[model samples]
Structures are given as structure tokens and as C-alpha cells.
Target: MRAVIFRLMGVIVLMLVGAGLVGWWFGPLPAALVACAVALVVIGVDTAAQLRVLAWLKWPRHDNIPTARGVWAEMLYRAARQLRLWETRVAHEEDKLKRFIEALQASPNGVILMDASDQIDWCNDTAAAHFGLDPKRDLRQHAVHLIRNPEFFAYMGAKRFDEPLLMRRNGSYGPLLLSVQIIPYGEGEKLLLSRDVTQVERTEAMRRDFVANVSHEIKTPLTVIAGFVESLRALEFSIEERDHILGLMQEQSDRMRHLVDDLLTLAHLEGDPHQPAEERMDMRQMVERLAADARALSAGRHRIKASADAGGLRGARTELTSAFSNLVSNAVRYTPPGGEVRITWRVLHPDYGDPYAEFSVSDTGIGIAPEHIPRLTERFYRVDRGRSRESGGTGLGLAIVKHALLRHQSELRISSQPGLGSTFSVRFPLARLDLAKPGQAAGAPDAPRADRESISA
Candidate 1:
């Protein structure tokens, strides 16, 4: 500003000197006064132009900024240079904010922001799903009011967020756990986070059940063995009594062995990531062999029959045998005396669909209840625990069947109705089934009326 004043002073001085020199050569007083007035007008115009530049700084834009001469033009250039620097900084900040929002959107966990009044400020898509809330529609709604879970409301009211809240994903449904936490942040604001913990809780429950079941199963046999050993040591017994006890002990030992073997099979199936070996297996011979085993297991108490229409399947031969044998053996064991257990294998294809194969085991026994049918394939799941145990079942047959079928990219489907009997079937994928083979080209043309019974299983 001082430099500007000095420059103005120099201009005034030069104007005076020129005017004085002209006036000295012509009319002295009047000419000098006129030149001094002109200099004052020039100074006023320059000051006004500077004022316009200062006004432009308040809400700066390029189009409205006036053209200027001399020092005023220099001031405008400087102002424009500073504005560009500020624009770059602002652009960088905006870009960073955009990236931050994208990162939150991509996060697997749900995140929500709330204001001091507990009103929703912003939320990601995951938060929307976790809370069953719409991101745009629910903005500014009260967090507690919107979530509406009693526990969630209590959590908000208590202002105690050290521990997270756990609730079911479907509040009306069975336990499918969700974890929610609130973190207090700046100026009474909070950050709410939620995660789906259903699988974790499921695993924990299964672990507890597995441990309890294993302990009980092992302890039953151990107790029987121990009791007999104690009897032999602590008291004298007759030869017949001793033999009876020994036989009972051996039966318990066999039961324990079967349980251990099933458990090991499950462990092996779960641990091995590689696919089962592929080998072509003829369904006819396989069914016959397994049917023979079923009859032996049944001890002629229940009638057993089997028919095969499928040519072959491609999978591990041993795995297929184990799975099929389990199904057949289960049917025989579960059937009452004089009841019939039937097994069938046939190729299935729609008019326009690729060919696949299905194997089913059906038994005319005490049919499973509708409720129990869904859980039949679960390990140790039973329609009647006493009946399952009495039938000499380890309760792992269906589970093994399920796992084996899964390895073949298939599923065990069960259909049952009380007093009507149950059917368990596995539908193999086209990739695992061989629709054509040398033998058994003619499908089950002479199949029984019951064999043709159509049910989902």
C-alpha cells in the first residue's frame, strides 16, 4: 500500500512538473490548476477500480472480474494465482472424502453414524441390511426408534457401550445371532457397528453338542466295561453269568468302535479338500452287494428288495459303497418285523434336460414326523432317540450319506409322513453320472407300483 501511494505521488509530481513547464511557456496559473484537477480525477478512478477488485475477492469468479491497467492488473493476477491454489486443495479434499465413503461401502461389516441427538446421519448398505432400514429414507430418524429392538433401545438409553449387543437376525425366528456395538466419538456423536455372527454361534453350539455327545457315547461303553470288570474282581460269579457279562461288554465295545469309526470318517471327509477319486461303478452289482449286506444286518426280520436302472456313476468306488451301504443298512434296521425295505436306482432326465441318476432307499417302518424329516441328515439327529439307539444305529449314517452325496455334488432328500414310511434319495449331478453303459441299457421296465411312487425325495 505504501509503494502504491509512493507511485501515485510520483505520478502527481510528474504531472505537476509537466503542467508547470507548459504553463511557464504559456498561461501560467490556469493551466497548472486544470492539470491538478485532472490528476485528482485519475486517482479517484484508480481507487474505485481497486475497490471493485476487493469486492470480487468476496465471491470471486473469472467472468465478472474487470479489466484493469498497471498495478490493479497486477493485483488481479495475484488474486487469481491464490484462488487456483485453493481450488487444488479443495479438489484434493473432496477426492479424499469420496474414497473414504467408497471404502465404507465396500466394508463387510455394517457401519452407521449418529449425531449427538441419536439421529441417524449416514449409513452404509451393510448397515441398511443389518437393521432392515433404508439408507436414504431412514436418514435423520432416531436410532433407537428406528431399530426398535428392546435390547437395542435399552442399549441406547443406558449410554453404556462397553459390551456389544447380541440379537437374532430374524427377531421372530430361531437364533441367528447378530452382534452390534456403539462407539462414542466426537461431541457426543456415536458410531454404530454391526456384524452377522450366526455362523460363529452355530459353530459354537455344534462344538458344545459334539463334545457332550462324544463324552456320553464313550462313557456308556466305558461304564459297562468297568462295571463288569469290577464284578469279576470284587465278587465271584458263575460261568454262565460271566459269559453273559463278557458278551454284553463285547457288544458295547463294538458299538464304541462303530462310533469312533463314524467320527473318523466325518473327520476325514471334512479335512480332505481334494475331490473323491473318479471311477466308473455299475449300479446293478453295487446294489446287489449292498442289498445282501442289508439282509444279513436285518437277520431276516424285515424283507429287503432292490432294483437298478442306472448304468453307472463316476466317483470313488469305496465312498459310493460306504454311503449306499449305510442307507440300505439304515432302512433294514429301522423297519419293523415283516416290514419291507426297497432300494432303487434309475436315470432321471427331463425332455430337454441333461441326464443324471438317482438312488433311493425306502422303508415301511415307523415313518418320521414332518418336523424331523428336515433334520434327518444332521449328525446324531433322530426322530426318536430311544428307537435309534435300540436299532443299533450310531446316528451317523444319514450324516455320512449327506457328506458323501455332497462330494458327488448331490444332496440327500428325505420325504416322510407318519405311518406312511420314509424315502431317502440322492440325485447325482450330470457330471457324476454315466447315462450309458454296456449292461442295464433297458431301464426299470418291470418296476413295482411302489417303486414308481413319485415323491420329492
Candidate 2:
């Protein structure tokens, strides 16, 4: 600024001398007036240009007094130019930062910005939704008062910025599992991020239930086997006693084998999210075969009845067969002596919808509680763990059935009341059914001669 003032002053001094010389040479006032006017125009133009440069510099402080041109003047001019460049760079950086913050606000995870005093400064739409907050109204509020979780409040009070807190909170929207983290930013500011973990929490619960079920299933059979082994090792026994022990051991072995097979089937089902669905088989024939298996498994303890209309269903034949067999076997195993297991297959026509084939298995067995019905399809979930284990159940049969139905675009609906009975039905979409193949058996299979039952005690 000083440099610019000096240049203006130099022009004025030179103009005065020149004007005096012109007046003396020309011997008139007009010549001096013209010289003065030209000098004023020159000084005005020079001063305007200097002011433009000064505006570009954006100096923190200014000194407008004129000074002589020297090394100090040149140094100050260079410093002003450097200051302008720095200001430009800072403005550019701020623009970039603004864009970054905008992007963060648009992120799916909830984000909240807090000041050093733990007051909320800014938050994104997701954060507002998670906390059931009004973005405009909730500004500058205390974070602790808004969240209302005891654990979260304690975490904030302790200034625990390193460890994140996981808590379940009930907001206006719904119950949500949140993982909250507080990060320290520049100038005593804090950035809080919250991520929904409801699905993760559910998966962990399923894992724990699965592990516990497997342990219990294995332990029961192991206890029986150990008892028989101890009995044999204790003393020499009569033939009948040894035979009885041997029989018990065989029963335990068979139960273990059945459990292992069911486990393997469940693992295979879970391994393939998208199973083949091109194979089509006769629904009537599938029902008959499953009923026959159920009757064989029941050993005359329960009567297995099957009724079906002729229809072809499209799906993985082996998987459907296995799923149907599991349901039928479960009915037969759970029902008491003289109880009935009825298997029905019929096309259901809704009042204003297409026809769908509904395959149902209803049994007169101990029913399940309403609360436990929803979780019955989960892997290793059982209503009566002891009874299920005693009946050689792996607790994965229903899970397999559920997955199989899902793969075929069908749905499984189970209805039950305590002690009355349980009905398990698989409703296939109408598009999945076709006419039965020519020359195939359309009705129930011919009853075979009585033979040894599949289950042995």
C-alpha cells in the first residue's frame, strides 16, 4: 500500500514542476491549467489501479501513508502478493471442506457434530430419523437429553472416545440396535456416528441358539451310550440283560445317525441360497410316497391317511420330497398311539385369484405355543427340547422345510393350539403347477403288504 501511495505522490511532484515550466515558456495561465488537468487524470488512473491491486492482496492490516521507493517498499509489495496467494488457497480449501461435509450428511449412516460443550451443532437426515428428531427443531440441544440411553450418557460423561457403545433404544420410529462412536475433531469438536445393527444382533442370537441346540442334542445320546457302556463294564450279565443293553445301545446309535443326517441336510440347504427349480413332479405321487414313509416310520403307533387330487408341481424334486418326508415323519413321530396323521393335497381357488395347490400335513399331536410358532422355522429351534431329542429329532427339519419352500417360491404356514393339534401347510404358487404327466398314476398308490416298521426301540 505504501508503494502505491509513493508512486502517486511522485506523479504529483513531477506534474507541479512541469506545469510551472510550461507556464513560464508559454507565458499564459491556460498552459499551466492544462498541465495540472493532465497531472490530475494521471494521478487518478494510477491511484485506481493501485487500489485494485490492494483489494486482491487482502492484507490483514493496511498502511496508506506515502513513503520513498526503496528496498523496504519492494519487500512490502512482495509480501502483499504472497498474502493474496495464501488467501486464495485458503478459500479454495474451505470450498472443498464444505463439499466433503455435504457428502457426509448424505451418507446412510447417522452422523452428528457436537461442540466442546457437548451441545449438538449439526446432524444429517439419517441421524434425525434414527433418533426420531426434527432436524430444524433439535439443533443446539444436548446430546444426552436427546438419546436418553443410560449407557450412552455414561459413555459421553467419561469422555470415552476410543470405545464405541452398542445399545438398543426405542425411538418414535421403532426399536433399533445402534453402534455409537464419538470421534474428536479439530478445535475441540466431536463427530458422533451411529450405525443400525438390528440384523447383526438377530444373526448373533440365531448362532447362539444353534450352538446350544447342537450341544444338547449330542449330549442326550452320549449319556445313553455311556450308561450302556458302564452297565456292560460293571459285571458279567445274563444273555437277556446283555441283549437288552445291546438293543439300547443300537437305539442310541440310530438316533445319533438320524440326527447327523438331519444336520447334514440342513447344512446342504443353507449352503445354496438359490437352488434348482426346474424339475417338476406329480404332487399326488409325492404325497403318496411321503404318506407311505410316514406309515412305515410310525410302526402302527399312528394311522397315516393321505388324500390328494392329480396335479404336477415344478420344483427341485429331491428337495421337495425330502421336505415333505420330514413333515410327514414329524407328524408320525410326535402323535401318540391311535392318533391320526392326515395328509391332504388340493388346489385352492381364491375368490378373485388364480388356483394354487395347497399341500397340508395335519396331525393330532402335542401342539406348539403361539409365541414359539414364529421361531419354529429357525435352525435348531424346538418347542420341547427333551421330547424332540427323545424322538431322534435334530431340530433342523422345519428349517429345511422352510428353505425348500422359499426356494420354490412357495410359503409355509403353520397353525397350532396347545393339545388340540398342529397343521403345517405348504402353499405353492399357481404358476408352479401344471397338469399331471400322461400315463402317470393320478391317484394314491396301491397299499403294499405289511412289513417291519422303520423305527425300532
Candidate 3:
């Protein structure tokens, strides 16, 4: 500013000097006219420069900045430089905002921003899905109006945000459980966070049901045993009568023991995170043992037969036996007298997929319904409580089978129709199959035979 003032003063001085020299040569009137002309020209030039600067400011561009001869040029240069700096800062901030929004959109939890008037300001995709809202259409809409839930409106109206609110909504697939919390921030605005708790809620319900089931299972046998003991202690009875009472007590005792053993097996399977050791097991011996157990369980009333292909399985022997035995025993117990239970172990060499070994137990028995098949692996899940008890089943057979097979990288597939029959098959991966010739194809005709035995009544 001081430099501009000085330059202006210098111009005035030069004009006056020229005017004085002109007045000395021509008259004072001509000299005054010359001074006025010089001043007007300077004003016109300054005005033009100001107009150019104003035009550039209206639509400023880096390359098209107005050219100026003096202070105007410096001013324009500084203005452009400042604008560039501001543009860079704005771009950087915009990028950060974009990333922050993207992170919120990708988050499993839902996030919503509401203005002071309780109107929707912004919401991520997750939040929109949670509330069945459209991000674009819902902007500036009243939150309570859109949600249309009395509980949520009450929560917001109460002005209390200490605890989260749980709400159930109808989802596309099924019912959805949401845990929502509101946080007040930034001049009366609110941030709402929502999380889907459907799975958590389901697990909690299952836990409660399991506890109830366990208590009931334990109590029923205890009641029977206690009643029998009281009768034995307080009543006078004949020898046969006493024997019958004793036998009843013993049956109840055995039922409780079996239940306890099954509970322990399930607990062990769930607690042990490590996979079963890959020990080579003789499939023939395993099959025969399973057949023997099934026949004994059937008490010679049902036919039990088993056959094995020429290959050994590599897995924990005890776990495999337990899993296979459970399937066989279930078949025997569920089948009526004179029914047939066939157990087969074979290798498969598919045309496209990896070779795998399969162990299948098929039973001609009262089969499971379609609805009950999905929950068959749940612990203590019984299709018929009275029938399961009468058959001496602890109801943990399929659950144990599921866990043990999972540890061996195997899967159990069940196909059953009510009153027709059920087939339970365990498919073992190639890694767990110890074929006689490891490289030999499973379908080769020349594959060496191990031992094959089939026993039926």
C-alpha cells in the first residue's frame, strides 16, 4: 500500500512538473488542460485494469488470469496462488470424507445421522437396509415418521440415551433383531448406531432350551430311581416283586449313566478344538465291530450286516468308532423287529471331483420327517421323547457324529422320509483315505482287497 501511494505521488509530481514546464512555454491555461488530460488517462487505465480483474474473479482460471502491468498483476498472482492452495485443501478434505463414508457403508453395523430437528441428514447403506429406508428419498424426512415404531419414538422422546433399544423387524428372509443406540452430539444432532443381533438372540434361546432339557432329562430318571428305592426300603414284598422293583431301578440307573456318558462325549468334542489325529484304521475291523455292536443292541431281533471296501481310513480311531457306532446303533434301535440294517464303506472316484471314501448306514425303520432333519444334530433333540427313552437312546448320537466327522474333515449327509427309511452317509475327504496304493485310482478294478465280511440274521 505504501509503495502504491508513493508511486501515485511520483506520478502527481511528474504531472505537475510537466505542467509547470508547459506553462512556462505556453500559457497557464494550456498547462492546466494538459495536466487534466494526463490525470484522465491515468484514471481510465486504472479503471480498465480493475474491470479486467473483476472479470477474472467472476470466472477465475489458472491459465486465463488477466495480464496486468503493475500492482494489479501482483494482486492477481497472489489471488490465484491463494485459490490454488484452498482448492488443494478442499480436495484433500473431500477425499477423507469420501473414505469415511465408505467405511461406514461397509461396516457391519448401521450408522445414521440426524439433524437438530430430528430429521434424517445422512445414513449409510447398512443403516438404510436395517430400517428399510432409501438414503436419497429419506433425506430431511422426520425419523420417527419413517420408522413408525412407538418404542423408538418413545425412546427418542424420553431424551434418555443410556441404554440401547432392541427392536424386532420383519426382514426379507425372516425376522430381524436389531440393537439400536442413540448418541447425542454436535449441537443437538444425534448419531444412531444399529447392530443385527438375530444370531446372538438365537444362540441365547438355544442355551436356555438346552439347560431346560438337561434338567428335565436328569430329573425324570432321578424321580423313578428315588421312588423305587423308597419302595424297596419301606415295603414288604415277595421275592419276584422285589426283583422286578430292583430291575426297574437298575434300568433307570443305566439310563442316567448313558445320559451322563453322552453329555461327557459331547462336552469333550466341543471343548477340543484340535482336529482328530490321522492314524490309519482298518475299515474291515471297524465295520465288523460296528456290526457286532448293532446285533448286540438289536438283541437278535433285527438283521444287521456290514461290508467294507479295500481301504483304511486315517483319523482318530476312538472318534471314528464312536461316530460309526452311533449311526449303527441308531439304525438298530429305531428299526422294528425283523428289520434290516446295512452298513457299507466304499471309495468313490468321481469324473470331475476329488476322490473320497464314503461310509453309509441304511436302515429299514421309522424314518425322520423333513422338518426334523435340519435340527437332528442338535444335542438331546428327540423326534419322539417317549420312543427315544424306550429305545435307550441318549439323543446325543447325531450331535456327536456331526462333531467327530467335522474334526476329520468329513460331512454327514442324511436322506430320510417319514416311515420309509433313513440313510446316513459320512463322506471322508481324499486326505483321510489310506488306500493300499496311495496313487491308485479309487475305481481301479485291480485294487487290492482288505477283508470283506457280512453278517446277518
Per-prediction RMSD in angstroms? 5.0, 8.2, 3.5
Please tell me which model should have the higher lDDT, number 1 or number 3. Answer: 3
Question: Model 3, range 382-455, lDDT digits (tens) per residue?
Answer: 99989999999988899999998888889999999888889999999999987764455555565533332332
Worst 10 residues of 1 by lDDT: 448-457
- Choose 2 or 3, whichever is better by lDDT: 3
* Number of residue pairs clashing in candidate 2, backbone atoms closer than 3 angstroms, sequence gap of 3 or more or interchain: 0
What candidate 2 gets wrong by more than 4 Å, as runs, is: 1-30, 41-102, 439-457
**lDDT by residue for model 1 (195-312), tens:** 9898888899998988888898889889989998998999988999989999999999999999999999887777789998798887877878877888888888988888787367
Best by lDDT: 3
Highest TM-score scorer: 3
lDDT of 2 by residue, 1-457 (tens): 6755886687778777777778788866866786778777876765765665555446343454233234344755777667679879999999999998889888989999999887899899888878777778988999889888789889988986798889887766679998889999988889999998888998998788778878877888799999889979988999998999899889888888888888887777778766685866867667778877887898878878888765678888888888998889889888888999999888666899888888899999988889999999888778887888778777889988998787888999999998978999999987787744445454545223231111211
Ordered list by TM-score, greatest first: 3, 1, 2
Residue pairs clashing in model 3 are none
- Stretch of 10 with least lDDT, candidate 2: 448-457
